[model samples]
Structures are given as C-alpha cells and as structure tokens.
Target: MEDGLVRSISSGLSQKGVRDHNERLLLSLIQRHGALPGSDLARIANLSPPTVSAILRRLESDGLLERGDPVRGKVGKPSIPMRLAPDGVYSYGLKIGRRSAELVLIDFCGDTRHQRQLNYDIPLPDTIFDFVGAAVSEISGALSPEAVARICGFGVAAPFGLWNWPNTSDESDAAFQSWKDVDLRVRTADISGLPVTLMNDATAACQAEHMFGRGKEFRDYAYFFIGAFIGGGVVLNNSVFEGPQGNAGALGSLRTVGPNGESMQLVDMASIHQLELRLREVDLDPRQLWTDPDSWTSLSRYVDPWLGQTAQELAKAALSTCSVIDFEAILIDGAFPPAIREELVGRVRRYMATQDTRGLIPPRIEAGSIGAKARSVGAASQPVGTQFML
Candidate 1:
C-alpha cells in the first residue's frame, strides 16, 4: 500500500511539471506569432504533435485560447488557427505627460479595449497623483470583476528623469522637491492593487511600434519620439536597449550643433513645443492651429527652419549612433497627426539626402504606424506582455 501511494504522488508531480512546461511553450508561441495553427505551433515550439494537441485541448478548456475556422490551403488537412482569447486577460497602461495623461486598457492580443485622456490645468504635484489614482479606480470600476481579476499589472510611461530612485542625502532632498523622484511604482501599485512597471515614455512608444507597428520589418533601428519634447529609444537585436536604471534612450537633452554652429539640445529644436510656442508668439493657439489647414501650413512654415536644423542635428546623432550600432533605419514618430508626421519625415529625408557621414550607412527614415497613440498603446501592452512573458 505504501509503494502504491508513493507511485501515485510521483506520477502526479511528473504530470504537473509537464503541464507547466507546455503552458510556457504555448504562451511563448502565441506571443512570437500573433496567431498560428496547432500543427504549426508544434513545429515552432519543438514539441511533439501529440503534446501540442494535448496542450491546446487543455488551454481551450481553460478558456485561454480559441480556434478560428480552419484555413484551407492547397495542402492536405485544413488547419485551425489558434489565438489568445481577447477577454481571457487584461492589463492597464498609463502615459503621464507634462500637460496631460492617458489611460488605456489592453487585452491579451495587445488590442486597446478602452482609453481615456485627462488634461491638467496646472502642473501641481499632488494633483497629478490624485488624478492618476482616480482614473485607475474609475476605469477599474467600468470593467467586470473577472476582467479586473485577469489584469496582470499596470505599465507606466513617464519622462526619463522621473525614474530616479532616491538614495543619497542630496538626492533624497532633491526628490522631495521634484515629484518625478518619488517612487511612483509603490504609490500607483498601492492604489491600483496591481504590479507596476515604469519605463520612459519614448522607450515604451518604440516598443509599441516594434511589436505592433511598422518597425516590425526591421530588427535594428532608432525610434525618435517627437512630442512636447523630442526623446528617442534604441532598438538592438529586435529588443529595446533599456540601459542600467532604465534611462538608456533619453535623447532630448543631448547637445548637438545648430545651423549657426551653436550648441543646442534636441528638445529645444525638434519638439512640438517649439512650434506651439512659435504659434503662440503670433497670437494663435496651437490646438486651434492643429485643426485649421491654413493655420497648420503657416505653423509648419514658421517651424520649418528650426525643424530643418533639428533634422540635421538628428542626422548627426543618428549617424554617430548607427556607426556604433549599425541599425537598419531611424524612425521618426510624434504626437502630431499623420499629416504633420509625414511632413517631418519628408523634410528630414530631404535633409539626410544632402548630408554625408563617414563609417555609417544612412538609415531609412519613416513614420511610425501607430502615430500619436504609440506611447499610450505601448503602456497598455505592459500587463498583457508580462503575463505572456512576451
């Protein structure tokens, strides 16, 4: 009787281990390939056909995966493609900007289910956290209990400087003054009751483009995120290179040469803030200018010179970085509309065409696929990506 009991326990443990291994493999496969047939999953996962079949059955039973209609080809049996069930899991993303913040809910497939934008009247420290916490609670209330339960965690995309964790006496004193230095992860997690991952807004935007946008075509490139400020993120070997402490791609503050051979920061030259300020100088609201075609044209004309100078500086930085990293292209993305982004890309391409650099090939410049929503969408993907280990 003792021998029989021991055999039963050993068999159960062996089965549990196998199930866990298969679960990991299944999740990995779904992440790498958006949707794939069970047969193809066996090949990609390097699992036997029987094992894949058994795992799929278990996952389907658990409501983790769903099968679409069989895709018939010129081959033998029609294969059914499996996809992550959209409602099976959920995650939240927050993009905290200087003037505004965006909250988004994403499903397992990285699709946005809901989104809300909140703007601030004043840049007060206390108000910012209050608004963020309120938004989380409001959104959570809107979703079903089951949906909320599936939430793996929350991802936050904020300014690079905001991530400095306090240590030294001076740093601690500075943290008290700057809201950015406060441990947002702890505060947000406490309020939202979920794990939080904080990353640079530009870096998160770049990852969104890489995973779900046009950058899917290239493995190595630099993503320049033009918004209120011009920040960038580097992608090497198809993954974002978040440096130690997660501040690798903060390009806004990098000093480069302007048209007059004077030193200028990328943010000062390339950001939409410059253009908006220029519009305000001429007695026009930028938000109004963005909507009017004539106002947009005038604003573009006013900003073109600085934009050109910014592009040149950008090219120099791209060339210098690419010489070391050898990326396939440099992607230009911004919070601007498609028309504005296209114009920026065209002008930058024109400038790059005339410029020459040594020891580096000029990278193809293109606009981002998701455009302005890249950062917010990327932030929303954090929870789903983490759950699936993507």
Candidate 2:
C-alpha cells in the first residue's frame, strides 16, 4: 500500500449512467435534425429498433419527446417522426461581468423566455451574492409552479480570478482582495437552494457559439469575444478544445504592438476598455457607448484609432492560431452593438488581407449570432448539454 499498489471497491452510476447517456445521444440527434423517424434514430444512435422504440416511448411519456407530423409518402404505413417538446425542460444562466450582471432563462429550444440585468461597478462578494440571490429568486418566482419544477439547474459565467483584477487594471481596489478565496459556485448554490455550475466567461460564450452559432455549419473554428476586455475560445473538430488548463483560445493575452510600437497584450489595444480610455481623454461620457451605441456612429475620429489597433492584433492572433490548427471560420462577437461588431469584424478582415500572410490558409471571418447574451446562454446551455446531450 505504501508503494501505491492499491485495490479498492470502485463505484459509479454504471447501469443508469449508460441509459441516461443513450437517451441524451438520441435527444441531441433529434434536436440537430429537428425531427427523425424511429428507424433513423435507431440507425444514428446505433441501437436496435426495439431499443430506440423503448427510449422514445419513455421520453414521450415523460413529455420530453413527442410524435411529429407523420411522413405519409412512404411505401409502408407512414413512418412517425419524433421531436423535442421545448417545454419539457428549462434552465437558468447568470453572467457576471466587470460592468453588469445578467440573468436569463432558456427553454429546450434555446430561446430566452425572461431576462434581468443590472449595470454597476462590481462590488464586494457579499453584495454580489445578494444580487445573485435576489435575481434567481425573482426569476424562479415569476415562473409557473409547473414550469419552475422543470428547471434543470443554474449555470454561472464570470471571469476567473476577477477579484485579483485590480492589481493590473486601473479599476483595482483593495476591497476586491476578498474574492481571491471565495467558492462562487458553492456559495451561490447554497443561497439559492439549487445546483450550480461555473465556467470562464469566454469559454461559456464559446460553448454557446458551438451549440447554436456558426458551429451548426462548421466543425472547427476560433472564437473571439469582445467586452470590457477581449477573450476567446477554440473549438476543435466538434467539441470545445479546452487544452490543459482551459485557456487554449485566450486571445486577450496575445502578443501585439501598441500604437507607440511598445509590446502589449492584445486586450490593451483591442478591447472596449481601450476604447473607453481613449474617449475619457476627451472627457466624453464613456458609458454612453453601452447605453446608446447609436451616438458612436458620429465619433469616427475617436473610434478609428482603436479600430486600427484592434484589427491588427486580431489578424495576428487569427494568423497565429491558423498556423497551428485548421479552421473553417474565425468568429467575432462582443457586448458592443450589432453595427459595431459588424464593422470591427469587417475591418479585421480587410486588414488581414493586406498582411504578408503566405502559406497560411485563410478562413472566412464572420460575426457571431449569439451577440451580447453569448456567455449567459452558453453558461445555461452547459447543464442542459451535460444532462441531456452526449
């Protein structure tokens, strides 16, 4: 035993876990295709006809799956199709950012049924916990009793080591030091009396894109999410490629040159924070960018510098990432307005064209449809994904 040669009774939910896994596999396929015949489900799931039938029957009885309009043109009796009943399940997601907190509820179809948000300077842990508690309670209380009972769980998305952020940023305060050791998931779950899961804000946003965005069209890509700071994630093949410690696509830390030719992290030149800092120099109310994006359309003089810097850094990161891995597309999404996102991505694309990139395959660069809610939607989608998908 001292030498580490050990034997023990190992235990897990062996039998039930397999059944659950199989059920999720079937459901995921149906969700992807919209609907499928029992025979098709059997073939796709690699299960026998009888086994597929049994699972479908069980799911139908549970109100999670149901018979769709029958395919009547077949030679045999019309083959019945099955599809998901969106009301069968629900989930809650929370995104805590440096500027605001957002809570959203999604149904089986990934549509937000209700949402709540607040914008304020991020405060101490106690204040945050209270806001989360009240937000969860409000959303849950607003749901019908039956719908409330159908909730799968809650998922949280926030930057990792956020409390230690002040050390490097101007926003830092000594009070935030208390967050260094807090277990946010456990604490939030404890107060809400519900299960909870946590993920890096960027990773969660990537998951949302993988499940609901251009991922529906491509199997691999790099995702860059812009907010107070730029962040990103990589999807390899059909899954999120969280390498080693899960910072695989952390584009915020990409090495780049600033306007002054000084070396800097990409976030320093390519994020909303940088844009705000530029605006602050002229005494403009930077919050106007968040509360009213339309006004920015007239401020090209102030925005052009930030745009040029961001475009260069983003192109560099994309080229660097493509050199190591093959991707069908590079997606850019952000908390900024739709017009802002589109223009930024376009500038990045045009800038990339001028760079002396040879032997490196270029992929289609596009905007992410998930937009501002990517993190929250992706966060909530995780619990549903783990519980009901393979």
Candidate 3:
C-alpha cells in the first residue's frame, strides 16, 4: 500500500529531486482528502517529519497552500492544518455540448468562481470560439492582477465526434461538419491565450467525480455519464486509464439489443436523447430537460420508462465492464435532477442483482455527486493536474 501510494500520487517521479516529488505527493494527498497537518501528511506520504515540515513551509510561502487554524489536541503542540489556497491557481473549463456551451472559471480547489454559457439548437465552431474568447476576456478583466497571474491554463471538454450529432438539418449538419477539421486545443489556446488541454466530455465528467466526488472510496471503477448520449471512463490503480490512444472506456459503444432484437450500441437505448425523442413523439417540449430548476415532475411519465430502460442497459454494460476489468464499483451520473439520479441508480442496482454472475464479483453501483457540472469541472482540473499533480 505504501509503494502504491507513492506511485499513485506522483508516478514516474522517483528520479527527480526527492523534495520536488515529495511536495507534489503532499499536495495530491491534501487535494484528495482535504486539509491535513504536517504529521498526517508525513505518515501518509512516508516522509520524515522534518522533510514534511520543510516542504509545507516552502509551499505555504509560495502561496500554493495556506495554514488553517491551529487545532489543539490533548497532546504536545497544536497542529495547524494546511490546505490548497483557493487563489493559488485558476483555470477555465469549456464544456461544449450538443445543445449548449459552458465556460467556467474555477479555483485551485475546483470551485467555480464565475461561469458563462450559450444555448443553441446546434453547436457551431464560430459561435463557440466567439463565446469562449469573449467570456475569457470578461472574466479575466474583472480579476485583480495577482489573481489573473495565477490563471494557469484552459481546458475543453467535448465529444469525440462532434460533427455527427443531432442530424437535425442541413445547416446545422454543415456547421457540425466544420468540427471534423477544427483543432480544438489549438483554437482554444489561440482564443484564451493560455495553455489548453482538451478531453472527452464524458471522460472529463469522470475526472470531476474522481477528484471531487465518491471516487476516493475505491481503487478502481467504471464511470458512466448520461449526457445527451451515454459515455464512460475507466480508472485503475487510482488514476484514470485513458489507454494508449486516450479512449479507454468507451462504454457507450458497448453492444446491446434494441427493442425489436436489432443490434445496437448502449447509447442507442440509454441516452437522454431517447427520452427527448419520446417527448417529441407526443409533441411535448423537450427543452425543459435542459433548462434550469432541474425538476422533471411533469415529464415523469416519459422519464419513468426511460429510466427503466436506461437502468437495465446500464446494468448489462456495468457487468460486461466488470467482466473485463473486475472494477471495484460502477459510478453513474448525468444531466438530471438528484431525485432522478437516485431513482436511476436504484434501478440499475436492482437490475444488476438479477443478472448471472457465476464467475464475477458484482461491483457496487453508486450515483455520482458532481451531477451536470462534472464535465466542465473535470475539464478545468486538467491544467491544474498537469502543473501540480501526477
């Protein structure tokens, strides 16, 4: 476990100066489990107390970490906890969905300090970049010089094949087609004037959940994010395994049967778009599903059936994933209300219980805590992780 902790927090850093690696290890530990005193950090990181104290002093002096109020125990001296300074670093996260684009300015601790969004029938590259450029300027202009200096980079979360979506109209299709040739990371950097990191939208959501939600509870898990379409990511050895080509857990493409016994992907039967199609079939407005207030009480009739089918499909996908990786858990999250998410998770768990698992150990199915913001928050974490963590 000690060796794993070392590798997990700062992989491939053994050759670097011990102090540099140890500093990151301490920061990573605090980020994962919140504020900790030097003593605890030393024990967790397996560093000497003097080494931990020296690193902590340097980090605190550099503004990357801040001291908390001294906690008095019935022991020797009062231990002052340390945590990541909220203003130590900043990054912008852009989540480009089929229906909307969101730009968020987040602090070191992953809290959104400001955000801007644009909604449209379909995403156009020109409009997205325009929004991004303007939003970045507006947000940065409002910050103090010191705060602005702390801005690290920008991250974008987008689907892999942006051009094939919606399939709505010729005009929208043409607009999407432009995405096929557009270089997202380069374009975003040009607009934002900061180092840019791009990630798969669903994978970004998994990152957010892993960093800020329930991922700390397990060493490995399969995460499924139900957006307009369902997608997923894989985590192994306490790190997201993006695979060789950076597409590890493409759960949405998992083979499944359609209603009439036709072959299909999990996305075909499990995406929220299917629920939107149901609403369209009955001439009900589907816009409410994406709008604020998040409650879908009026659409419960349509949502109920969608939840049932989605849950069953997710159950099959979860088991299939575990068959390959033996994941410790399966996490489910999406662009929906908490109540609806809870219902979906419960249904998935029930469905999994009835599946055959003679050669497999069933993994726990839990709801993700990040909800709709996971993708954007996950995107923002990229630059911070690149600079400060493994």
Candidate 4:
C-alpha cells in the first residue's frame, strides 16, 4: 500500500510537469502562428498525438483555449484548430511620442480590441504619466473586474533617450529642459500598477512588424519608422538586435546630404512632422492633405521632389547598412497614410531599381504593413512575448 501511494504521487507530479510544459508550448505556438490546428501544434511542440490531445483537452477545460470546427483538406481527415480564447488574457500598450500618446488594448492573440490617442502640446513628464494612467483606467473600466485581473501586463514605447537625459551634461540638460532627469518607467508603473516593459518607439514598431507584418517572412531585416523622428530597429535571426545599453538601431542620427547639397540627419529629411511643416508653409493644412483626394493629388506633386531627395538619402543609408549587416530587406514604415505610403514606396522602388550594388543583393523596399499604429501594437505584444522567456 505504501509503495502504491508513492507511485501514484510520483505519477501525479509527472503529469503536472507535462501539463505545465505543454501549456507554455501551446502559448508559444499560438503566438508564432496565430491560430493553428491541434495536429500542427503537436508537430510544432514535438508532442505525441495522444499527449497533444490530452493537453488540448486540459487547456480547453481551463478556458485558456477553444477548439474550432474541423477544417477539411485535400487528402487528410478534417482537423480541428485551437485558438487562444479571446477573453483569457489582456495586454495594454502605450506609445509615447513627442506630441501624442496612443493607447491600445490587445488580447492574448494580439488582436487590438480598443485604442485611443491623446495629443498634447509639449506635455510635461507628470502629465504624460497621468495621461497614460487615465488611458489604462479607461480601458480597464470597460471590462469586468475579473477580466481586468486577467491582464498580463503593460508595455510602454517611450522616446529612446528618455532615461539618458540627466547624464548628457548640465548644458545639454538645460537644452532638453522638460525631458531632463525623468524616471518614466518607475512613475508610469506606479500609476498603472502593472509590470511595464519599456522599449524605444522604433524598436517596438519593428517588433510588431516582425511578429505580424512583412518581416514575418525573414529572419533578419531593418525596420525604419518615419514619424516625428526617423527611428529604426534591427532584427537579427528573428530577434531584436538590442545593442549594449539597448540602443542598437537609432538610425535617425545618420547624417546624409539633403536637397541642394545641405547636410541633414535622416530624421530631418524623412519625418512626417517635417513634411507637415512644409505643407503648412505652402498654405495647405496637412490634415486636409491626408483626407481630401484633391488636396492629396496636389500635395503629391509637391511631395514627389522632396520624396526623391529623401529616397536618395535613404538609399545611401541602406547601402552602407547592407554592406555591414547584409539584411534581407530594409523596410520603410511611416505615420503617413496608405495612399502617401504607396506613393513613397513607388518612388523609392523606382530609385532602388536603378542603383547597382556589387556583390550584394539589392534589398527590397516595401511599405510597413501595420501602418501608423505599429509601435503601439508592438508594445502590446511585449508583455506576452516576454512571458515565454526561459
């Protein structure tokens, strides 16, 4: 009797271990492939058919996943797919930019259910923190307390040098007066009461692209985000290339020659903010340019010359970068709407098609799939992605 009881206890512990391992594997598979069939999960997770069946049953019982109807294929039995339950978990993401903050709520499957944007005029650090907290509260209030309790965490895509302000010498500190000595992570976490994962806006945007957009096809690529700043992120072997001190792909600092032989940083040449200012100078409101077809058509003619100049600088940067990293592609994504993006991509592609680089493949240039919300959406995935860390 004593031996039998010991054997039963050992079996129970072994089963628990198996369950835990399968749970993690299942979640990772869902994250990677979105929704997949049980057979595919079994193959990806390397679990036997029986084990996969048992695990899926247990997971469904726990409300972590739901099984859909069997899908019929050409030559095989209909296979039922399993998906992460929409209500199983929640994540909040906040993208903090120079002039605006975007808040997004995502489910375990990386689906955005709610999003809001808050604009400010040179917001102080305190106000930024308050705004993020209020956004979180607003999102949380929409759900039940029980559902809110299932929230995984929050991710913040903050400005790249937010924490380095104080160390930039007393003179530089005074120059960036509002940003100097701000502890964004600690203060924001205190207000939100959730574990915060902070990353540069461009880095977060790249992460979003890698997981859900065009970069999903390549293991290595460079993602350039042109918004208020020309930001960038590098993916090496399907992971973010976070350099020492977590500043790997700050591409905005790359200096290139602009139109009329003037030197300017890539940020100055490519950022939407600069384009907006130029539009305003021409007595055209950028908001109208974005929405009205006639305004866009007129704006396109003005933008083409500037875009050609920007494309030249971008090509120079890409050539230099490709010589070093040999990335599969260099993707350009911006806060510009789809129509504008298509126009820019068309011009960039035309330029790139003509350039000849020796002994290296010319990197493909394409518009970002996630559009303007890439950073916020990428931020939403951070918490859930980190949970899979060993």
- Using lDDT as the measure, the top candidate is 3
Off by over 4 Å in 3: 1-17, 166-168
Predicted candidate 2 versus true structure: per-residue lDDT over 93-138, tens digit per residue: 8888877788888988788988887776555678777877788888
For model 4, what is the error of residue 86's alpha carbon versus the real structure, in angstroms, after optimal superposition?
2.3
Candidate 4: residue 347 Cα off by (Å):
1.2
lDDT of 1 by residue, 61-122 (tens): 87779988889999899989988888877878888765567888888777888887766522
User: lDDT of all predictions, in order shown?
Assistant: 0.74, 0.81, 0.89, 0.75
TM per candidate: 0.84, 0.91, 0.94, 0.84
Task: Give the C-alpha miss distance for residue 308 in model 1, angstroms.
Answer: 3.1
Q: Is candidate 2 or candidate 4 better by TM-score?
A: 2
Best of the two (2, 3) by lDDT: 3
lDDT by residue (1-390, candidate 3, tens digit) is 134234544554453455576778889999998999999998888876877888899999989999998999998999999999999999999999977899999999999999898988778899889999899889989999999999999999999889877675688788888899999998998887899998989889999888888988889999999988899999999898778876778899999999999999999999989998999999987878888534477778888999999999999999999999899899999989888899999999999999998899999999999998889999999899888876
Best by TM-score: 3
Quote the positional error of residue 273 for candidate 2 in Å: 0.7
What's the lDDT of the predicted structure labeled candidate 3?
0.89
Clashing pairs in 3: none
